[model samples]
Target: MTDIRIDIREKVFPAVGQAAAHAAIQDFHLTLHSGEFVCLVGPSGCGKTTLLNIVAGLDRDYRGEIRIGRQQALPKIGYIFQNPRLLPWRTVRQNIELVLQESSAGNTVDFLLEAMRLTRFQHVYPERLSLGMSRRVAIIRAFAIDPELLLMDEPFVSLDPPTARQVRELLLDLWRKRPHTVLFVTHDLREAIALADRLIFLSPSPMSVIGDIRVPIERHLRQDENEIEAFRRRLLDGAPHIKQLL
Candidate 1:
């Protein structure tokens, strides 16, 4: 088996200065292996993003341990937030290069620029690029670090249906080229099933694992209308409650 492993045990987080002290994750636990594409799905306000932040070492107020492999639980992580969050003043290429420079991996900028198909808009500032183009730059910036784990928090949430579909395909292509453990958080069941090897569902608030389903489809499968619809149906079957929302 691969040496890469992610283990989260009894994780919990409480919001501070709130009328009602809310628990974001109550005893949440999971294990992930290398090259696995895992998608986390849940209703709104389920603390999915909070859990991701903890794993990424952005939030340290949580209980329980997160271990990677047999080592001391430290793994380089790349985070993609809901919005592109690119600097308006910087061009597309400059924004990506900034992240690369931060990671001291400036040499990888050229490769990432081509891989993300942002070469054409390399000199275009964030304000000049379309929403989809900006998001693509963000994705490339995250991946440029060559992180062992990639945490994507609804990175395509703001795109239109067609644009989102294209981005999904592009992401899959990138995943194939560079295999890493990916934890993608999204509310869209279809997107989850279409991209992930395993789908994990969380309960409402104070989230806990409600369901775990393995998608048997191959990664090479084309994302056609029929395939997407079938995958969506399969995901709904795995989590019946999701049917009402769809």
Candidate 2:
């Protein structure tokens, strides 16, 4: 687990093609405590992905300060993108092992495969697997290395309700077993409430922090559909702005 402090003063995109130069993120500040699950919720086309990219060191052309731990050490990072991004040629187990070293890759792979219910498909190729299966493989691959900081960008989008629910449960199970600081970005308010310990809402274009809400439901009660719905209703009814943007 790792503590993360992010203070992005301004993140501007250079003019390209017909699009003019503009600020995607501005005056955004957040601190993720170790082993906490935080969700970023906002409108589509906002700077959610931009923020994740900055934190993951994918885009360095930005003015900000991102520190990990007390002395600012580089933390072990795991990223799950919108798509699975798995190697189609490799088997499910091989694709997961691709990110782990000899020291880190062992029973960890088998444990994750079994936890995610992918043991039967471990030898199967990515092309033969369904999208949900691919997503599960991508998830375990991220967990295989035992990352201290996990960054996810709307990883469960476009799936059917049943598939999405099952995947969410699997992800929660993995998270409970291996606690880590998670910075997850999602568009679904209910999903955010169900998964996140804290929720951060962003503005439309010049993305900035608009709301910070802590989920009030107990961890054990989060699985109940009625509890989730009731909590979501109370949260939305109390905050009109959050309801509008989310």
Candidate 3:
């Protein structure tokens, strides 16, 4: 893990033909320390995903500076999107192997599968697994890449509450074993509180950092109902705007 700096003075998508340039991010500056978990929370369509894309180098038509590690060589990045985006035809193990190269020698896949409790389903196809299982496979795949930074975009958006909680627990466990710089984007305030070491609130569209709050409780203590409720009440009392996003 290494220090990463994101300094985006402005990011605009050029107009195609007669359309006007769409501004997605403006004057957004953030620095993430090694192995820190930071969550980006904001309203719908607030360009949270766009910011993640820019950081991931998926979108280049933007004005910004994103520096990774200490050198010009970009660190490995693992991205998990809203959907699992798995190959329906591939088995869970095969899907995990897809991102692995021959030169990359490690027991990462085995370790991740064991840690995530996915060893039993290694031979299962993506379509045969439940939504939760599919999402878990996607997560394992990301970790298999042995990334220095992990970017997740609403990874548990559509699951039942119980399933989502399970996934979150699994994520925390994996991260505890091997921490990486994580930038997670979601609109769920409670989820943000549960997972992030720091919470970054963004404005609507043409998003910019509006607030940055550090979670005081330890990661293991986050699952306590008393702590969660207390944090929720605190947010409602001090940060009403964030409560309204709920």
Candidate 4:
């Protein structure tokens, strides 16, 4: 497990011909502690993805520093995108096996495939699997690397309610077993409440942290709609402004 410290003073995208330069993120920063699950919640197109890109070291045309633990070099990072960006040519098992850097990844690959209930589809390619099934494969691939820090960008965005809930359970199950640092980006406040140990709210673009809190209800109680609704009511009663964006 590793602690991540991020300090992004600004991130700007250059003008595209007639369009003006857009500042997606400015003065954005976050610190993720070792082995904790933290969710960044904000409105759509609010630069949540941009912040993840900075933290993941994907976009470098920014002014800031991101330090994972004590190292200058990056460790093995596992990322799950907004879509199942699996290699179409590869089998489910093969897609997972590709990112592995060591021999021990085989055992992990086997365990995660069985755990995600994708053993029967291990030999199937991405094109053949349903959306829900493909999402399962993506989850397996992310965990197969046994990464120290996992970054997820709305991994359950388009799924139907039941399927999304199932996938969320599977992800948390993997997180519990692996126990590593996770920086999950999401727009759904309810989903954030259900998944995170701590939740940080962000303002709409040129975003910055507006509020932060630990989940009041236990993980087990989160599934009960009554409890979830009650918590939401209590929270919103105190801060009516947040309800508008959420």
TM-score of model 4 (CA atoms): 0.94
Against the reference, the lDDT scores of all candidates come to 0.79, 0.90, 0.87, 0.84
Looking at model 4, the pairs that clash are none
Top-scoring candidate (lDDT): 2
What TM-score would candidate 2 get against the native?
A: 0.96
lDDT per residue (tens digit) for residues 68-145 in model 3? 665644579999999899998988988998999855624877898888898899898888899999999999888887
**Models sorted by lDDT, best on top:** 2, 3, 4, 1
| Residue-level lDDT tens digits of model 2 in 10-81 | 999999999999999888899899999999999998999999989888988988788876655557889999
lDDT of 1 by residue, 165-235 (tens): 98888888887887888999999877887898888888876678777778887766747557767877766
TM-score winner among the candidates? 2
Best-first order by TM-score: 2, 4, 3, 1
Tens-digit lDDT string for candidate 4 (1-246) = 567788888888899999999888888777788888899988888898888887777888998888877865565688889898989999998989888866777788888988888888899989999898898888888888778888899999899999999989888887888877888998877888888889888888788887777887988888887887788788768876677778
**Superposition error at 138 for model 4 (Å):** 0.8
List per-candidate RMSD values in Å. Answer: 2.6, 1.2, 1.9, 1.5
The runs of at least 3 residues in candidate 2 whose Cα sits more than 4 Å from the true structure, single-residue gaps closed, are: none
User: Which clashing pairs does model 1 show?
Assistant: none
Task: Tell me the lDDT of model 1 at 200.
Answer: 85
lDDT of predicted model 2 = 0.90
